[model samples]
Target: MDLKLSERYEDYREAVRVFLEEHRSVWRQPMADSDGRPSAAGRSWQALLIEHGYTCRTIPKQYGGHGGKADILESFIAAEEFHRVGAPTGLANQGISMFVPTLLECGTPEQKERWIRPTISGEIVWCQGYSEPGAGSDLANLQTRAVEDGEDFVVNGQKIWTSSAHFSDMMFVLVRTEPEAPKHHGISYLILSMDTPGIEVRPLKTMTGRAEFNEVFFTDVRLPKTQIVGERGAGWQVANTTLKHERGMLGDPGQANAMLGRVVAIMEEETLDGVRLIEHSGLQDRLLRLQARAQAMKLHGLRLLTHGLKGEDAGVARLIVKLNGTILNHEIAAFAIDVLGELGALYEDSPHLKDRGFWQTTHMFSLGLIIGGGTSQIQKNIISERGLGMPREPKPASKGA
Candidate 1:
């Protein structure tokens, strides 16, 4: 685990910094959809990232990517650079973050050829069809079914909390293909096009006044046999690969650090008791703690990346980092709101505001971090069982049993 970047990597870092600086003004606009939906500007930004070899940094050069080592340190640097200049990281969602990695690991060469390049190029957007009304954290109980029909599978059922489904062109779905087998063993993963006739996307509005998530209905939506990623009935295993990717995306410490920097800047611009808000000891103490946590999380991320590069299991560590990261984000958001006092209530673009009303929006958006990816409770269960080696929780008894 060398922390030292090679001369080449240092050069790469400097190049990325210069690109971001040149585009800083373009990236400064706040994304339109605060519910984590990608905006038109977001899509354009993603294309710029791909052209500059930032998106899919980990994909091999042979596969139409930059062929970097999938290094977490590099990801950290990239995230920090983007956040420092108020730029959104291209395609920071379950699709690019989770599904792309799964496809690379288990997909056929044809599938990769069909999907990966387009995804990286921002020509196609993707969503996850994992959670159903009944299945969320108990994802093994997912009811979306994909019945085999000749050279294609006919999918029917519904997916809930599908972020970006409305704007996405494709979705990576987990479907129940073998009803008679046990819950976890009877599933399969499929890639389905959103334009398929039977697919319906209805946006779900949240407290943030944004339609960021959607309820996706599949009524006989059909996918070609070639769309299946891994073997049928091995969806649970395939999902593990996706979750590992999710953990990495969610636990990214660079995002927290970026938010911390924004808070510091806001505090400097603000005043209280005839002095700057940043000079307040209470606020300073809290910011210091957040900075320390961000550093620790970064180091932990490095360890996970080193192990992952060596093909080692990092599931437990991923969960631990995600659990800690979300909590830290919530705390930082809370402090920002408190420090802003009455001014925190102002929305973006409001009259006579500080930092263009970003603090208020950030405070509102922070809660989603805890709930999305996987809930805090779900992360705790993983940590308890895998990290502590605790006994599995007892399953509820069936009515007939």
Candidate 2:
């Protein structure tokens, strides 16, 4: 692969740098609330980014996006510069990263016009309602029921592990619309206001001490029939589009590189035995290995981008990223803790905590990433059976066959 970028990209990179410099004060200000949800300031900054064609660039302008053509190289440059300056390229949320693309692909024009503007403009937030108490990895097993009754559907069930449910304005959810149909076929995707009567949200605190995830209960919550995205019994198909974007978001190579960079910084600043941790031979070896892996991931991302530009299927390569990227990120965070030794145990509340205990928080969150988009085991099975032509694991005979 050619390591050098062309002159056009070189110029584009400079333009990004100039734009960030010009808007330094606004972008450098705090963008999120204490719980990491986008604040008013952050939303305004995001709108500025959209106006400048810096983010949500591929979506059409009519939908409150920048409306630039898709160009992965420009996207990479923008992300890289944003990371370098510690400015957010865009608000990271299900609304923008996961659901917007899904809506663009599967929503009716009216649906698009109604939600996309407010959602992408940060006027509204949305949470995914796919997982349940019983059905997570096996999502088709979801039992949330939405019975149609006179031009409306009355929904009743509980959804767990829903991120940002408490703060979101609305949700894109899956519910059983036809009980007699096949497990995967009877479901339907629908949008509902979080403030609808009979809806309750109880946040679940994670190890990081943040309540970003929640349990959402719907008790006869009524929704309009028009809220359904695709056909009544075809939610599984619409949901796949959301899941596809979700996996890509979770496995971002840029995020992995940022984690690695932080780890390297920790190594350089930390010390043991009257010497910098970076000077230790054992730590140096580990650092080199991680650096190599980070490079490999970037190169692999370039290959995937090439395939996308050419309209060619990347096959297993795309499937493998979520698994590998999450694992590598977890390892990088763990390595940071290893470098800090006992100090790593200190959290944000502690005065002696290094980097404000960011690594400690990240280390815990990274473990969740391994399980979130799709569990590592599930991803492996997908790669094996679907990508490599391997036979799937046989199902156990039901009771006594």
Best by TM-score: 2
lDDT of 2 by residue, 36-121 (tens): 66888899899889988877887899999998876767777787788778777778778888778988999999999999999988
The CA lDDT at 248 in model 1 is 46
Runs in model 2 lying further than 4 Å from the true structure: 34-37, 243-258, 399-401
What TM-score goes with each of the models?
0.82, 0.93
TM-score of 1: 0.82
- How does candidate 2 fare on TM-score? 0.93
Error of 1 at 121 (Å): 1.0
Clashes of each: 0, 0
Candidate 1 ranges beyond 4 A from true positions = 1-9, 18-53, 68-83, 86-88, 149-152, 244-254, 273-275, 279-318, 348-350, 398-401
Candidate 1 local lDDT, 165-240, one digit each (tens): 9878889999999999999899998887889999999999977777778999989887787788899999989989
By summed lDDT, which 10 consecutive residues of candidate 1 come out lowest? 243-252
Candidate 2: the clashing residue pairs are none
